[model samples]
Target: MSNAIDRRDFLKLAGLGGVVFASGLPGFALAAGQDEFYFVQLSDCHWGFEGPPNPDAKGTLKKAITTVNALERQPDFIIFTGDLTHTTDDPAERRRRLSEFTQIASDLKVKTVRFMPGEHDSALDNSAAYREFFGATTYTFDHKGVHFIVVDNVSDAGASMGGEQLEWLAADLRQQKTDSPIVVFAHRPLFALYPQWDWATRDGARAIDLLLPYKNLTVFYGHIHQEHHHMTGHIAHHAAKSLIFPLPVAGSVPKRAPLAWDASEPYKGLGFRGVSVDTQSGQTALSEFTVVKKAQANATDKT
Candidate 1:
């Protein structure tokens, strides 16, 4: 198939609202009729979270799963970037939330699902519970023609990847050719968006230095609880929308608290996204979908 993707084709692939960002596949090449796949990215579900920011916290994740299942085309896989559950002092409560989140996510029709940890999920216990539920916090895997690396920035108390994981990342990057298409998943922004609100990784700059040598690299992350796009040299960093509640933009307000729930817009800033990767051209598009449909939002407004 040709690398070119038309708008209609992209919408059909996403089956939801999308604002496309077509980044050229610089340095990576694939022959005609090569691998082209799309995946769903849902982040910061914060299961067990209950408050004014989201009264329907318990139901939002399930709604997202149902929406994904209703998609016109099922994704090749699904990945949850981080913050699978809200933070709790009680270990038992944390595990309970993780278990519940996993059970609900299993309803997805997709075959493969990947996960990582956010500070809320890993910081308290250093990911002991998260590991028991998910696998290693940091690892690398290849899908089709793309190289994917999951980094653990939340497991460390300092919110840094730590020296050991940094060494591991460097060793892994050494194995790849410069032309390889690399995608990174992390819980926090790899670049400093705003440190005042803790939106940035403590030692993310070191990790970026390690990644700067590559010609084709992109980072998908969460924890900011909003859709954000940034560039560090040629590498692109995109943050997914949260499944629980949305937060104010970096330094937008005095604090980093979640945006207040909108009565008129029940699921306004809360939703998940679908990422489409065209291996032939090395282009990726993101489609954003709300947790509830227009009718649902309207009904909530009427009530």
Candidate 2:
């Protein structure tokens, strides 16, 4: 299957109901509507990472939870895309950070919180600690009429879903009807956004190949720390903004580094995403809500 997004997919985003997604879609307009159900996506929290880029980092995740809770209509569940903790080589420190991160996320009003690993959580010990806190890294579940597939792409550090996981994904998809709406969640973009920075998954091509046969497939991923969308055949991919800090666009600079925070306003570009799926309307609406200075952040801020 070709990786290039078609010109037609951009036209569909206009009718998607207030989704802040960038694609090969040129001259797209925005619109809003009611949804059948909604959920929140929180990514790249980097709980234990300390740095000058963000002064109010300590309250980042907590602030995200508070904002989601204040939503007029609470989401049905929450999914943390990855980077539950900072990169820690210490075994005990890994467990400590994961524990703290889980505790904070556990405070959310919605109980069904699903987690996948980023390089930080899965690289060192092959995600053993993450699995202990969260179940099998790659699995599937059903919500409403949509089939949700969560894949583990970070355990290898090469951003490739190994052969074994790929096979499992194949078998999982075999059970669902070809026309069922499918949503895939992972830490890294399945396509090669930047091979040097590991933004693109090394073995992601095989996975995308497997998914090409499906008519209704969409991917929600993180690690890029910004809003992006693409189309491969009929499959659409959307990358979420981060909870910690924003990163530079793919290949915009020599290095793939997190963008420096605005000195005047902290947490300006950091926020979470809310995605609502309305089976009735056959539409999905995504909104990126920014957290401003850990106070007075509105969830309605589009992108």
Per-residue CA lDDT of model 2 for 1-303, tens digit only, reads 332222244235526542435323221122223225667888999989887786667877787787777765567788999988988889899999999998898888988989899999988888898888887899898887788899988988666789899999999999977777778998999988778888888888899999988766778999888888877666778888888888888889998777887755667778777776644332455666765424454232322
Which residue pairs in model 2 clash with each other? none
lDDT of each: 0.81, 0.76
TM-score of 2: 0.86
The candidate that wins on TM-score is 1
Regions of candidate 2 where Cα sits further than 4 Å from its true position: 1-35, 280-282, 292-303
Q: Per-residue lDDT of 33-121 in model 1, one digit per residue for the tens?
A: 43666778899999899978888887888888877888766777899999999999999999999999899989988869999999999
Off by over 4 Å in 1: 1-19, 22-34, 300-303
Worst window of 10 by summed lDDT in candidate 2: 23-32
The positional error of residue 243 in candidate 1, measured at the CA in angstroms, is 0.8
The superposed Cα distance between candidate 1 and the true structure at residue 103, in angstroms, equals: 0.7
